[model samples]
Target: MPEQYDAIICGGSFGGLAAAQQIGGRVLIIDRLEIGDGETSASAVPIACLEKMDMTHVIDQVHEEIYLHTRRRTQKLTFFRFCTFNYRQFCEDLFARTGAEFVRARITSARAGRVETTAGTFEAPIVIDSAGWRTAAGKGGEKAARASRKSFGVEARQPYRGEGLHFYVGPSRGSRRFYWAFPAGDHVRAGLATYTGASDLSGDLERFCDDLHLGPPGKVHGGYFTSRLTDAVRDGMFLVGDSAGMCLPVSGEGIRPALVFGQVAGRLAERVRTGEMRLDQALSAYRAFVQSRGKGYRILDRLQSVLNVLPDPLFALFARYIATPRMLRYANRGYWNVASPDLLTADKAADPLPATAVPA
Candidate 1:
């Protein structure tokens, strides 16, 4: 007999765990790979989520100063607080608390209220696809999401010393993007992101390290940052994180938003399971929440286009101006919050209905 669950979630990552943590009862989390194996994400999430979730202990480093590197000079911006943590471990720990039964399943198909996996079929009234860019939970929808832009980031544990979070913004051979070096105690996450091919990024990353007089990273890691935005809900299926484009355009910060969205989706799933809301009603509610919450990300999408058009010189000048001491305070705060308000606060007004209109 197929196993039954209150909700079946795909991809046991940040967004998936977030949903599981909030959705009580018999929940199942499926993933093809072992948890956190071969994962190289040194994620930086907002301090608010970390504090609320009691995950502040996962933080490996806290950065209050930011250094923006340009062609001519390195502009220093201070007073912005960012915490870098081991995202893989964060997911693992959070998933453990939800008491969700985990299965090793490479999902073959997902429909309105059923999931077929290599291990077995799982049935639920509500299904959530919190999977990352791969969108494994969005099975039977469209093919893999097509990305107009892509990024490759690698992190290595080698000898490095940097007091603040460093971001490199300048000319690359390919599409416009910036490189970042986040110091995480023992190692620094030194990687670049661009709308270019992986091979091109690899070469560029090598040159970037050499130019900075830092040793080359060992065992460089890479993954998709975004696959463009797609529908967030349909037929009792919900997609969060990169699948729903929770990630901001230029900054690509998805952790905080993913947790917030996943929690909302999970709570709605609970309401549906308990008959507080109908399945269609739950889908509508989820769609409305995603649309309203994603407005800021949509704005960032446009800003990325503008940054792409500006010449290297112009971009450098703009960066320098933003980093000036007089503007740094405002810039520091704006940089972290360009997408939306602190989600932990902005999401308190969540009402399951009548806020957004859905197309018929």
Candidate 2:
């Protein structure tokens, strides 16, 4: 019999590996790295939404306070937000648990039925295009709109200090989007998200470090991220994680969505393999599921342009004001939480951006 697989998942990163581990079928996970050297290894891995998922093994309690810093003000938030990781280690563990064939090869070209990789060609009835970048998948053009979103980050080990996580928001000359700082464990990661375009991220990263009084970044590490807002599934394949453009438009947080959809895709793939579900059924379900979670991202994309159109001073003021208690609560628990289909949909009600808040 020909070498057959129920699913061939490309890109053995978080989502790919997660899906592979969760599914019960003959699986082949293809990745460009030497098993654990891609974005998964380099990620500033932080997983939230644990109340709804089982991550006790992966998550570590964050007893420290959480801080949200605006230009002139800082606020303390609830501790429901947890920080847990071992980015590469967690992924490697997941891979080991999968019991699937692993190929340390790069997928060069892809078609509906077969995929060509640096290692060799593989013929799988279901070809999952979790390849992270654009590729042919029985479809034309990109799976989604290619937004110019990129970010750079640096992580280094140091003594453990119980300082809460800090996120800095400031406009960038390179683009309208600002920078971010995620301080987890011993290392403090600072980076800039250039939504407008890609340029010298190193300087932007340095500036981020400078602003936070974290000078002389040691063992610097940085990377880029893209935002996509469209369907991520095709004929016999589905895209998960960064491949599906699940990155948060405002934050560039991809891990949460990646894992969510990864398990969803894995479950659906099993259904497809059992002939209990058609490919379209699975693809459509994943599309609807992501579109629901992505509602906030869609709204954020709209709000970003509005923020850019405003003057810097005014923009800063708006950011500060939104940090207020009542406003922050509503924004998180109300406006943004609509990403969960179980919650209300932004499309079903009044415009989220208030008329007064929006500049004429």
Candidate 3:
């Protein structure tokens, strides 16, 4: 007989870890990587989120402003506070807090109450697919669910000191491509991304580094992130993070949404475990919660579509428009709030995981 658990969570990264933090009973988390072994994201997020997770110790640098660069002009906006963190450290620390059993194994498939892995099979009433963009554990096969609507991003870290996050756009780098440099302590993560599903970005990334006059690229890491939204609940299993296409459209921001939705899903699952609600009720609630952000996702998706085809001169004008006080406020209150209304609030903190429910 397969080992049984109160819940079986696939993928032990941001989404899985966040969900594990909230759940109670004998929770089992499965992933191919030992905790913190892989670092795929650029590792930047709003500072408030770090505080709420109580993982601020891993923050590498804090950025209070963002600079947008175009061939014709440059614009600086300081309406938000963001930070770059040590991804490995962040994951390891967060995992230590969960108090859940973890298995380093490749997940083969997961259905309503059964999760099959290379190691063995595990049984649970609740199963969450937080694996990733190419995860095979969802309702439809990974190919069907993620057929198109995927964006590729790659970045390399190099020794350079910089302040604030910077974004460059113009004919110099292909209008359809977006380039960014995020400062993390003494190093900067610089790279280029194609809105289209182009996977080869090493040459582009090298050119970007040269244009910025940064040092030789060091370690590089990146992968595809879904550019479109998908169902939150698939085949009776809850999906979060890239598995559910929670990465934002224009900015490719996944951490915030993953953390937010993971928490929500975990809490609802706990309600089911404790009989506060039924499994179907939890599924409906999660689906509704994800759909509530539909308008915001669509708006960003449209903006991404426009940016992909917008001319350099018009893009410059749009950049200028974004720098205006009114637009900056809109970005802070409207654009940012779409994922989580309280994300931008300075004083907002995530609810602490219930001690009485979590295993010791």
Candidate 4:
């Protein structure tokens, strides 16, 4: 017989770990990597998000301003605070708090209550497909899964010190490319991303660091993330994070949404596990929650499309307009609130779990 668990979570990163937090009983989180081994994101998020995870202690630097650089001008806007953090430490700390069993195995397939992995198959009443865009849950198959991820991003760390989160826009790197340098204490996480799904960005990253005088790039890591929204619940499995295409379009922000949606799915799944709600009930509620944000996602998607086609000078002008104090306030408030802490309280609050790690 296959190993059994109350819940089986695929992909043990932000989404999986967050889902694991809300679930009680024998839970298993499977990933090909050891917890905290793979670092994919730029590793920056709104400070409030870290506070909600109670992992703020892993923060490396706090930023209160954004520095936007264009070929024609540079603008500095202050509206909200963000922080760059130690990714490994954050993951390890959050995983320790989940108290969920973890196994380092690549999930090959997932159905309603069964998941096949390289190591073995596991069954659970509750299964979450937080495995990411490449292996979305359900019977979508590999072709459809690959086609859904339309954007590719790559990032590398370099030895440098900088203030605030810096973004660059212009024709220097490509017609539709943007680069960012987020200061994380003594080193900065610098990266370039294209909306066109270009896979080779190492040379561009090297030149970007050269232009910014940040020295040679350190370790590099990144992968595909979707800007287009997809089904949140598939094959009777709850999907959160990139698997559901929850990454923000123009901003490429995935961490916040992963945590937000993961928390909701986990809480609802817990209700199902406890017999307070049926599986279909939890599925409907989660789907409804994801669909409610469709309008915002569409708006951002449109803006990203516009950015991709705008001329350099025209883009600079547009950036300046948005950086105006009034516009900045409006934009900041709307973006930050997308993954607001208020969502965490949407369900009946569960007491904090003891900080413990189920040995992997």
lDDT for each candidate structure: 0.69, 0.58, 0.82, 0.83
Error of 2 at 266 (Å): 1.4
lDDT (10s digit) by residue, model 4, range 115-198: 998898999999998987776343556565533647888898888888999999847335477899999999989998888788
Clashes in each model (backbone N, CA, C under 3 Å)?
0, 0, 0, 0
lDDT of 3 by residue, 185-223 (tens): 988989878788788878888888888889667788998
Ranking by lDDT: 4, 3, 1, 2
Writing each residue's lDDT as its tens digit, candidate 2 over 1-360 gives 335687888878766875675566788888777566664222433334433344336553353445655556666654335464556566676777778898787677665567777788888767776655443342444433233443333343322344556656565343554555555566655555555545566666666666567775565554555565556675557777666666656556666666656766776777777787887887787676666656577777777656545566666577666667787777766433433212211121132222222211
Per-model root-mean-square deviation over C-alphas? 4.0, 7.3, 4.6, 5.1
| Model 1 quality (TM-score) | 0.87
**lDDT over C-alpha atoms for residue 341 of model 3:** 24
True-vs-predicted CA distance for residue 228, candidate 1, Å: 3.6
Q: Estimate each model's TM-score.
A: 0.87, 0.80, 0.92, 0.93
Give one digit per residue, the lDDT tens place, for model 1 in 1-360: 888898998878877877777676799999887766536455876666777677777888888877888778787765447778887677777877778898887887776779888998889888888667767644455464434454555555555667778888857444765788888878777777764435346777777777767777677876777724567874458887766766666666777767777776777787887778897887887787677545555666766767756777887787777767877766455455532224432122244332222221
Better of 1 and 2 by TM-score: 1
Per-residue error for 121 in candidate 1, Å, reads 1.4
* By TM-score: ranked, best first: 4, 3, 1, 2
Clashing pairs in 3: none
